[model samples]
Target: MRGDGARAWLDEGLKLLAEQGAPAVTLERLCERMGMSKGAFYHHFGSMPKFRTRLLAHFEAEYTTAIIDAVEGAGGLTARERLERVVAEAVKDTGPGLEIAMRAWAKQDPEAAAVQERVDATRIGYLRGLCEEAGHATPSRMATLLYLALIGGAHLMPPLPPAEMREMYGVLLPLLD
Candidate 1:
């Protein structure tokens, strides 16, 4: 009976996804984690396909769109500041587990792959924009490096911490000067 709401289900799903990857996100496991049942899940999502669709959408909006919106909406910052904010906001978002899970899922699920692709493009595009604004001679290159460093950090055996990642960004960011 706990976690009856749709948001609850999606939130739980994201947690499961982050902890266990795509294959581990079965209704049984999800319900077990939520202390609920399949009926509650079906009541909210209607079908597995529908649920997956909604879940992917939710991840994109929460983990990607939200970060971009926040940074873009922040007023009066210089481009370098915006770039720094992008790193800070992304680190604050801290989706390493979910990021790895979604990427692994994307390898098998075309739907996930498409969403991942769009998400990547949008994230990188934002970085590139910020870099361009910062007057870098090679904005795209700088942007890609920044984006890749974050992605690479996520894949490390221990997974870099936010503090360390920010420190790393501090080092790389000066290249833009």
Candidate 2:
């Protein structure tokens, strides 16, 4: 396919995936959305698996640079401020159902699982670095626990009121100190 065609397909595919999840990103649907032929799809992606690979790469790049960067940028701030900011930032996905959908898909798809493994490793590494910067011992283990807790809290505590969340952070932050 032409460069413009490839770009259009990828953009449309990602939008469809984010809004409706992976199952909604069928070749037929993409072709219909882009008003293109199946030949165009094959020309760029070769196959659905190839397209999925590209999509994952795009996701990794965007999430790391945007959300993760925002989280890590908290480094110069107090640890408590950092954690609260990270918590709020990580959970603030803009209609990209892809993150949660990808997590669910990881349970059954080896490729998805691999993507998640990379994401986890990156998150742990960031947290570990932060803990070290704070002069904390056992940084790796602490990073793991903190990373897991943040993810768990984000999902499980949906009704987490703002003031209560702040209070919870107040309780946990000193533990890190």
Best by lDDT: 1
Clashing pairs in 1: none
Residue lDDT tens for model 1, 20-84: 89999888898888998788889999988899999999999988898888887998889998888
The true-versus-predicted C-alpha distance at residue 60 of model 1, in Å, is 0.6
**What are the TM-scores, per candidate, against the unseen true structure?**
0.94, 0.69
Model 2 Cα lDDT, one tens digit per residue, 63-115: 65566677666566765566567655554544335556667767878897898
Cα error, residue 160 of model 1, in Å, equals 1.2
Steric clashes per prediction: 0, 0
What is the RMSD of candidate 1?
Answer: 1.5
Angstrom error at residue 128, model 2: 1.1
